[model samples]
Target: MLASMPGLRPDQEGPSLAEQMTALPVATLVVRPDNSIADANVRAETLLNMARSAIIGSDVARTIRIAEAGARFDIWHSNKAVAAYDIKVHAGRTAEMELDLMIAPIVDHDGWRVVSLHAQSQARKIGHRGSSGGARSAMGAAAILAHEIKNPLSGIRGAAQLLESSHNGQDSALTQLICNEVDRIAALIDRMQDFTTDRTLECQPGNIYPLIDRAAGIAAAGFARNVRITKRYDPSLPSANINDDALVQVMINLLKNAAEALEHVPKPRIRVETAFRHGVSVMVGDGKGSAVLPIEILVIDNGPGVPEHILDHLFNPFITAKRDGQGLGLALVDKLVRDMNGFVQYSRDREAGESCFRILLPMGMA
Candidate 1:
């Protein structure tokens, strides 16, 4: 009966699904109906610090017990379709590391399952301060330009309105064009004013999950409706000292970009995760002492990865991949993060074909 099913072969054809799953960047496991391990991926083998031959045929719960002693056992035993929990792994040569585990069932494979695991390392730290002076100067220049243009724009609109009043028929079209161009320039100035304003963040120590949830909700209701959003949160994550409003803006910008990138892909997905990291430090500038950044927020998207051409200048002002984009979203995000003494960087996983953005911030003022 199983052999008769489409895409299901009783005998081996090419590489088994287990073998293909094992080749993925994510750690995977194939379990029998009785929850015995049938196969393990190469990433899983390395993550567990064990050989695949030693792990196969082992009872799934027994393996979990040995590998993740601190894991929540009840969650694993509940037979849930999806679960995420943290565990500590002792790296032989490197320091002990914390890891997040995701377990999900695989359909059409006879009750088998695949588990994806990601290590929680401190993000690559960045200096506390960035090129804020340059940003401020740019904003100043924009503000001046807006002011200079607005005066002439108002005169142009008034002159056009007067000309329309005096026009008999066909010349009204030219007056309308002049009015429309003036309105467009005014709209551009309004957007630029957001940056020109001198606004300071009201920083406080607060839970970041709510901000992430709010942004995710906004995305789902609009641009990201077709995309699946998964959350893997560390319950023990410490509150971060940041401006709640600014953080929300940052998350919204990131979610919007992720949604835009996944528009053409099937099964679009984004993952929001937060955790505490240790041993990561950043230097403010050349010859500056390093300071540790322990709090981390990660936004990961599974879409067509970023283009190679613009990868290097992704954070620069006015850099954008989308047509009709003002290119200020990320620039604003970078400025806001810097104001909160945080840093953001992007990484592309070519093999997995995913783009990941990591934001590192101080836990609290020291």
Candidate 2:
């Protein structure tokens, strides 16, 4: 509710109308009786990707375009509050943003309305913070990997060296790839040597399909050897802001989990897919504003879905459906993606009889 409106007392002890608008978490715009934007809060500026100077005094109809072709702007004609969900807001020449909107007419001011806009993906904001149990588990797992995994990596590197000398052409290249991959794993382990869990990943603009392909190849070469895998990539997907290594690990973990789930299925099939989701955005850790995350990566398997008993706690640390599982994989996957400003979710597509792990990430430059 706004303060110092026509119905409020002049000596109201709480925050002023301007202060209330400024402090609102959701993006807000106060429209004048003429349907011109009288004022917009900082959140509004962020949502529209425009400055206050550009937004204020502009005709609301000209500045904010409701992307629904048949929808009419009738809030000014009625006093009743208006609420809409899954609406696309296209401001100026900017990309269309998906948001829920609420417009309520000012109590005594005719043709005046307060508009609130919130992103559809606002609830999926997951970022690294020190106190989360997942972070603690990740730190412990990192220490263990740094100590235990390094020694085996060395032995593998040596074995690859022994094979490289006896191989030729394509075989030699395979051996070389093994050696290179081992070294990369070793470097990642070295970074995990730190137990602080406060290290930030180096993220850059990159297409995720190649990383998905790499993960699928690794999975097929080992745990998922018997499982049929397919790819359904959106050819026009934009680049995503990502740490390539982290993303590959996340995909590999999900694939491995799905493969394990299908261990006893009659005909196991896993599908890896990517697409662009319109208006999918999440609030960042900084709390300043939200980041539009249109890049979606999905790993789906026709397995007997996650067990109902542990489904609610699926992403939490040490939660597992496997009898001998350490349960660190999903937790680590969650941490890694969140560290790169992305989020992961799990769902069962009952109609398709598939277990799906979906990841949404911010867009990177082309």
Candidate 3:
């Protein structure tokens, strides 16, 4: 075994270390006990501009050099994980590249480590740092804009509604349209405020199946009327600690996005699945340790998938693939999930021709 967890066996249960490394999108290298490069994935081959055959069994120090003095040796000596960001890297004979590195020792193995590298360009594009300065600035600006526009929007809607009763024929239809558009703008403003608000949700132990079904039912009655919806849930899945309203909101947003994406597809289909995923956890608020997240919810869609240009920023505010989208749906979904100590991720299953949004929530403590 390349690595071992306390009670989990990679060989029988989940992915093997080699398989996981190969699946990663970023470049990865495994270092042997003797400081030789044990393995390099295809991404590593491309980044280092060398064949995998040539990279394996080569001296780790000579093949991948970290410009941060003693940074590489420190992890080796301490046997601890190290995360070095925006550091210079020299790969083989290639010119220097700024990259982020995640170096961690292989459990149950001595002097064996796995190194993952993210090029600066890739890192900048896909990195989700919503708490960053730029994101905060954008959110601040939006909050102000939403506040200023909401009052006027409500007035416009009220005026249109009053005028609708007095108008006839084409004029009546126009008044109703004005009211509808104004209400739509008001709704958009409310969603935008979710990004600026810092409200804490009161989470409780509850069955997640009901919430998922409720959201799906709502979608079927409205935007997803023509779309095929399927639900495959693990009945034995444990209760998750989540805010009922927040979970429903998150599901509805995801389902609506999926329905819209499949608007032009020949046979559009969306699947909502739930299961107990083993060995999944994330850092807790205190940052002293992590909380296990075993409950998994997936919203899978067979559509054209998100545009590649905005895939990296799919959850970022104002980054959208839709022509008329305000892009706060996923952003708000991200916030609400995190507030409940859960996490979400999106991936495109190229072979299956599907887009999947996976949400993992912690089991109820009670």
Residue-wise C-alpha lDDT for candidate 1, range 1-366, written one tens digit per residue: 122335756664556565567579866777776778888889878876778897788776656542443432333443445423234444322346654455666667656776566664322121112346535765886799788998889999998898888775559989999899899989877766667866777788888889989999999998888899999999998888889888999999989988888888888999998888764444343323334567888889998866777665566556688887776777677778877777787887879888888888778653
- Give the Å shift of residue 156 in candidate 2: 22
Q: Which model is ahead, 1 or 3, in terms of TM-score?
A: 3
List the candidates' TM-scores in order.
0.58, 0.54, 0.66
Query: Candidate 3's error at 335, in angstroms?
Result: 1.5
Residue 77, model 3: Cα distance from true site in angstroms: 15
User: What lDDT score belongs to each candidate, Candidate 1 first?
Assistant: 0.71, 0.76, 0.78
Off by over 4 Å in 3: 1-139, 155-177, 284-286
Candidate 2 TM-score, true structure as reference: 0.54
Q: What residue runs in model 1 are displaced by over 4 Å at the alpha carbon?
A: 1-129, 157-184, 197-200, 285-289
How many Å off is the CA of 121 in candidate 1?
19
Deviating ranges (above 4 Å) for candidate 2: 1-132, 137-196
Better of 2 and 3 by lDDT: 3
